[model samples]
Target: MTDTIEFASYIVERLKQTGVKQVFGVPGDYNLEFLDYIEKDPVLNWVGNANELNAAYAADGYARIKGGLAVLVTTFGVGELSALCGVAGSLSERLPVLHIVGAPSTRMQRSRALLHHTLNTPSSFTAFTDMSKQLSCSMALLNQVSPDTPNGYVDAFDETLRQCLTQCRPGYVELPMDAVRAVVSTRGLNVPLPDSHAAPSLEALRQLTPPGTPSPINKLYKDFGFFEPKPDEVTEHVVKIITRLYEGAQRPIVLVDACAARFGMGPIIRHLVEACGIRFFTTPMGKGILDEHHPLYGGCYAGRNSLQPVRDEVEASDFVLYVGSLKSDFNSGSFSVHIDDAHAVKLHSYTTQVGYAEFPTTDIRHVLPLLVGALEGVKSERPRVLGESLEQKMKQGRVATLVNRPEGTDIVHKWLWPRVGSWFHDNDIIVTETGTSSFGLLPVPLPSHASYNAQVLWGSIGWSVGATLGAALAAEEEPDKRRTVLFVGDGSLQLTVQEIGTMVRRGLHPYLFVLNNDGYEIERQIHGATAQYNNIQMYDHQLLLPFLAGKNPATPFESHVVRTQDELHALLLDDKFNVPDRIRLIEVVMPRGDAPEPLLLQARLTAEANSGH
Candidate 1:
């Protein structure tokens, strides 16, 4: 039998080669040996979280930060089971997570016996993959599968991991104690790296057709479209649009998203943004590339919850330049209306295949820079600021309307948001959840450098916590960048709160604002009646008990439970709470009647539509 240490070493080394720097988990009886090996290995940093769920979430965060393969180790039975929640989150977001699990000895495979923390049998852990894959990008394992493997461990683990990696999804793996002891030399292992797969070729690109344009990939080289002809077909076409934009436009803007980064268009994006001399706002996922503090930075375009000034800027722009954007809900303000006045030119991989209902051109990824190049000789006469400061006046009017509700100690959603916005700086990233908090305050206002990130397209409630961890990691990578902040409601926070310990263990100091309004306020608002079943049992609002509890207990976290506006004001003004190692939970005692307006409107609209309204 080979030494288990070698196997551990191989796995750890391969993980490192894949750019994995941290592993999230807790020790358990079945995985004790592996944990021992981890303790001995200096290269692999094992983060001991308060629970398996948080550890799993931490892995999600690390994977997001590291951007390719992320590893999370857990023991058999309950340890593996506890992590399913976070794994489910990873699946929903299409994030890749290598869940390495330690199983009981192979000799005990068929032993029909109950074990501690197991439900009747020890096979429950493998069953989770079936559900996990449905939510994640994909799932699989590194190990080869074989028939006669009880509980279908091979199929469950291998398939899940393979799909996650190949499809750019999340995956899982369970290592039997015997397998950990098996002899496997590291010399031949093929560890993968980010973007290892080649991108689509020029041939494939040419094959793509513009919306309503019959120019297929094969026809691209056939026609000398840009050849020595008058007006240079492509150049003329680009100039006509540019000339029109220059003559008609006022307050031009460019909006970019993560797709730009994915396409390696950083330099081009910067050039276009600079050339246009218009303000730019990136989605939370698309932050960092553009310095938010720049005068032309318009702050995050989505999820400010009625931050009027930002919305006004976006809506008033005469021309909106979109680069590599997929137009997901988060980037689109949960499908809220804005930028109605501007002509939009969207750029993306599939721009040519489908026409945008709202814009003049599609498939701009290539056309954009081409347009910029063609406009090289053309003078820019785009207006500086449009309509005699009309945009600014409109923004102030909207802000006034939001904060003007009649007096009551009850905290209005609009009023609550400004506090968070007021605290923000240019470099902070805000990770939002998919409930009332994200939608109620329609027009979001952010510091020039601040941005909002959420899975608005997916609208997953529990995604914010794990996503925040990933965002924090992204923020930390930038030199001297402001810390990432999470504006999570109580109900959503509980779903993924386990990651808090993982954050602390990894030394990520993101300030988590747990808006403890006591229930799933969004659902209740829409339903107009408390769905008692949907409401979760309350937990300590301030103290993070989950992080404090370990194999050996540690002191409970010092938390503040605020219940009024006065308390929040005092807390925000206080410096101690802002300091590291201290978590203050401001419990704004909002009325149980507090409901997100959009949810209520949506429910009303649904009912009306059902009645054939």
Candidate 2:
């Protein structure tokens, strides 16, 4: 119909149709033609990067925020190889990323003999293919071999891409140079893409119940050195305990963590939260599934760093329910709260296992929904606000602390949270690093998709910046009205700071706030001066310069060093710096030896022990 769009152009069209606003990668001689066409294609934005690693990282971020497949393109050889770290990370995290690599032209393959930029053999491609198989269990290979129907390449390629995305969530496809311009018969290339697979059948769900815990599952739990309770016997008991808690508490709240989304129990959990009119809040890792903006949302309920208003709400509530949430340090603020000692009921997969009780660990996907259904006749009072003024008091205290910073000082954790919170809207997304930034900045108070990626199972540093990029990419696909924000520590920033270059090159504008606390403050706080070895050599604070590339690369972003409260006060009031065309980097120097809240410390210890510490 339209002169049969070129294969590369068709790719741009299809990705655009899937709501992909941009693709991240570098241009090279092998894929010059493809890159040329992409430059002129308005439907797709080519996010060029300094290195393949950052390109992949940026794509990961974009995918996490966008909630779909993010494409990262690279030249053959080293460029392709550099993407492995990020691809591996994506696979481990279960994020969908499309890696499209450009190989030497098909016609020149015989003559190249593993030319300068080419691999000695197809082994490199084979390795990537293997990684794809291991990561997603789906694969696609194309190299312009079909002469009968040149367009068959595009059709086959598109179909495979769809399968990888819907089924596995992460995929890899390699394209040779000659195939970029392949022209195939247009007869059936225009067929609409297939729909996503249907939901699992109701009958299939019913059959999931068992007369007793399966031995394999039992063996699996035992191997983990976990004490397995009688899951089948306790399911009823736990459901009753939760139903009673709902009946007794005037203001009951349920906290769901990453388990809800990973196990696919979001719908059921939301139904229960609504049916019982209980307030709900998800840990940063569990922000999706149950939209945080929903009225039933109570916001992330951390203590000190809890959003000003939300903290008040949490303090006012008499009961806290742990549903699909492990009592990890990140969730409990480092074991700060006495969860096992608290009067709340904890409902995980199978058993209503009381706090610290030996319980059968079950998959929440099968358990939560069934558990919710089992409580149909158990009526309960709607969760109510016990103290209307509590939120107001918290808000006032937080505002005073944030708006006024001490003079001639680096940023403190407490002062930073409120200002950052002010910049975010109800639906904006946040991904925070683990260092002081994670320890200091409590989850923002707003109702948005915020993921606290600082590892809970372990205190992993340098996880947030990359994770933020991933979470942002994941959140981007939700709808038009969403933006991603990253809060990182100076120490954590050093670990993955290369991503800044990736960000600028890809034209991805995320608001990055780095807590420039001079050195490893968190480690110092924990281990004291005896941990002097934790110090890292510093670099020029502005690291975005090396990555910005284009025919006419204009440095449109701004980075400022804020020392006093006055400077922060002046900056927040200025609205012009928040535009998408520019990136605003605020480096707030903070006092050394400041530890993350004690709540986090306690939570971390509890999580460590439970995680087989």
Candidate 3:
């Protein structure tokens, strides 16, 4: 006789099997039953978020730090709609995030009655799922028990999850209100889960191999890894072109990009870089991809927008080998990075380019390991490394000088970033907002074992606040308990600031650096510097901790306001302030128009592009 279990238990069990330990979302009438199973499971922890959007952003951040998949739950219609942008960010950023929506019962849907969260139309029931289809790699609506899927919806859930992991992108599934209580065969629980894929051996993931160790995504990002390559687009052809370029060129360098950080290519890239002993550089999106302390790391390269030494080094190279490059306007310095197809070879998750030739062959996951042997022998013959560390130059007078500063001088972008870099602690998880913080953090040198998170490609304002909560939870769970720090502007913080309360409720201690610039500074650079449209109402940021946490909170918290350069310096140098024992919010006031150099450069290029130049 086959054993049986509720559908909700099966979903919870499958999630547990996939290595996910926590579920994030706000409880709604539709999802309350399912949340029960999550809470009851000893292994699964339910993180009740302030809102659905914040939940999705939290899920995205969690996926990034865990280096794998994450789970998000939501109620149908209103809840799911609120989360669309966050889920869209996951899709655009290529994060393996599974979004499960608790939908209305089949009976209620067939009746077509206007529900609280639904529109007054017959199509309202399916409209949300249809809208979500465009945002996810795969999706499934589980409402039946078919022979092919013996345990009702487990097989379909498993398949959709497999597709999400295979692509390392967002996925979707809808569970009806009644279906949560549907009886399914417990025997299916023993069958492998949505977590394991490709390997015939279920034990391999834990024993030796890992998941989503795919290639660095293509920096060009034209195909987004969906196109079928021609017969000539083979891996062998790419290997041939790369080997030839390396052997013939006097100066060839390795460049890593956004895909390198998301697709688990860090170790492989590092291994190849160390074995070859050649200098390497990263695109802005590719920061934290390798050990910055590595002598071979030649700071960030962004066309004319780069530092003088960095620009000189890359522009002077005879050949370039790019790994998972992303050349968006912001990432590429407004299309200023120019490279001859004949002198460069680009690698992607599912494609490879030999100069102008594109290979739609096996993805980077399969091709990258092979190159470890093919190119490890092609080290540079001459020393081409920059004379001094780019970060040191940025801090030690190249950008700003610390000496003889007026005590009341307000913090500026050029002067602030380098100082922040020096304050970074080992194993810190740095999260930067899409505005100034994102571009500004690029010049700062990260400490050993530190990881950087930025929504560079997506450029979503207010994303970092909620992301910090998820990243902090993930970091807290790690063996070393890495400290999570967030750099967000006061303007951007207004959008998703409610998550701050969520972080406090969860007892997570993250460093919140609120850059108070009075308004949307990034927007000011792009279009309206002094336009009233860019202005935002100001709030007393120093009171955020106490107000958000409520009275007599168990979580330790502190807040500070810095108006002068001297005060800022004193705070950063405080030993007690630097410790991660409590959640600290430092409100640093700055001039409204002050912005990072890269952001300014990008704004100028964008303006020219807009004017049809």
Candidate 4:
């Protein structure tokens, strides 16, 4: 018989089983015991962050790239509360994060004794978990133990993790101080955690047909009729409706969004796009979900901000297949996408919509493969070749528009992003902050196998710094050792700049590019042009590395500042800087008011919207 282990050890082993190599968090008195177990584990590493918020962001970022559950360990009350914002972002973006909070001992909780991190009220113990319910898919409070069932806490932990994986959102668990060492039977660890896929029950199959009718299972024919179809049958019918819409339309197009990656549907969607010769486009939130290098890949479609040809093709399409679309204002170019509901078929993570008809419980995972099979040999009258010129136009505008610029000319938004694009290599994960950097990098064509990370819906500034640290760690584990590239405005960088020190301490070498455009440039575009409230204090960008790196760094580091177009162009061509042996930071300065062309158009639309136009 196998020996029982401490509850903390069981939790660590379970996390490792879920593919979590690192646990990101801040150590506290409440969590110290749990941290010891995590650190001593052979398979798991403890990544100590400067703060709990950064730890949460790192965990979320790690989950985004690793494609499995990411674990974050924080202490009770203060620590868990600090990490709530990050957890909320993960929930909004559909990323799976397991947030484990170390709480006071069971005795302390039952006695209602005041604790240092507690709110000093009778309800203090349960306050965090109650608040967490709003941001997490599941929550487990393990303060009370069942006398009859010693292993009851394990069931709660298992269910919380299961919900996190199945929902692709955050989950919470509060482990009391004493329970950390509570021994539990290791029997549960013998069997692997169940996946999201559930087999159809025999009872469900019987419900699909009327009494005395032939089994619907046997009727795989095209004309199979149902007397009373179950949920699965209705989902299949919706899929067929979408398939027919695509097959019948002359000028059909596929639009992808961020949920494709969040729900692990990128490969399936790519297969559908490639197998059917249809023009493909991505919303700003969906950027990098599809390979921009694909011959049939068109430019990004952000409503009015899209290129003329891309806008024309998408808006004028006879039918549109929008997969995992999160039509937020910024993503849809201030809600300006002109596709009519009658002509579009939308697919979400858990729901599918054929025009105005909505089908709940119809997962994109089940429908995509069927859609791909139905449209394998189907060809649209609008050839995929139409996308080539549009792609070329995007590239030409970047390359030709800035060529032969005079010396001493100030760097503008137009020249900066495209210039940065030339430096991107394959297997690079590009993370952008929520301001100008987000909108600026939209048109830059990502290389094959590259990913563009942005918090478009969350719109949280300073998320990229911690996220980059997490992504770099995740990438280091990959076979090819993908590079993590970050683009953040000076204002956003100030919020989570301490993570740079964490990256240095961890020996991660992400290429950090800070856009030093004075302050809050994206916000300035949306509302305030020259308002003092929109501005922030400037810092010596070059000094950031030296200060963050400190003395006797583990790895080599490089930092540079470029103010003019010629200097920026020359830096991109420099091999030594391009192929750095360590962490590299490039601060590209641009005019205060200048922003990306698309961003400027979006700003105008946003301004008009606010004025009741």
lDDT of each: 0.57, 0.59, 0.80, 0.81
Q: What tens-digit string does per-residue lDDT give for candidate 2 at 339-366?
A: 3335565554333445444344333443
What lDDT, from 0 to 1, does candidate 2 have? Answer: 0.59
Q: Which candidate has the top score in lDDT?
A: 4
Model 3, span 1-613: residue lDDT tens: 3587777887887777777887888888888899999998898889999999999999999988987788999998899999999999988877889999999887888788788999887788888998998898788877433424555477677777776776678889998988888777777667654321121221222122123443322322445656533323455566766786887787777899977766678888888877766678888888887888777887888776777778888888888878888888778888788666788878775567777766543456656666777887665566644445665665566743344353448898866886787788878999999888988877666886898999888878889998998899888778897889999998899999999998888888999999999999988998988899999999999888999999867589999998877798899999999878888899999987889777887788888878989
Estimate, for each residue in 1-613, the C-alpha lDDT of model 4 and write its tens digit.
4578888888988888887898899999999999999888888988899898999889978988887789999999889999998998998888889999998998888888877988877788888889998888878878755624767888888878877787678999999988888888898798677343322233433333322334443344335564545556867788778877777888888899877777777788888877777788999989898788788787799999887778887898888888888898888988999999997988775567788876655666667777888888565565555457345766565322444443558988777776777778887999988878888888777787898888888877789999998898898878886788999999999989999998888888888989888899988988878899889999998998889889978778999888888787898888887674699998988878888887888888889888889
**Candidate 1: tens digits of C-alpha lDDT, residues 282-344:** 654465446544556665565333245666777777777666665554455444546553376
Error of 4 at 531 (Å): 1.9
* Regions more than 4 Å wrong, model 2: 2-10, 104-112, 117-125, 143-160, 182-253, 259-272, 287-378, 381-410, 447-484, 494-510, 522-533, 542-556, 574-581, 598-613
Q: Highest TM-score: which candidate? A: 4
User: Which of the predicted structures, 3 or 4, would earn the higher TM-score when compared with the native?
Assistant: 4
Which one wins by lDDT: 1 or 4? 4
Error of 2 at 502 (Å): 6.4
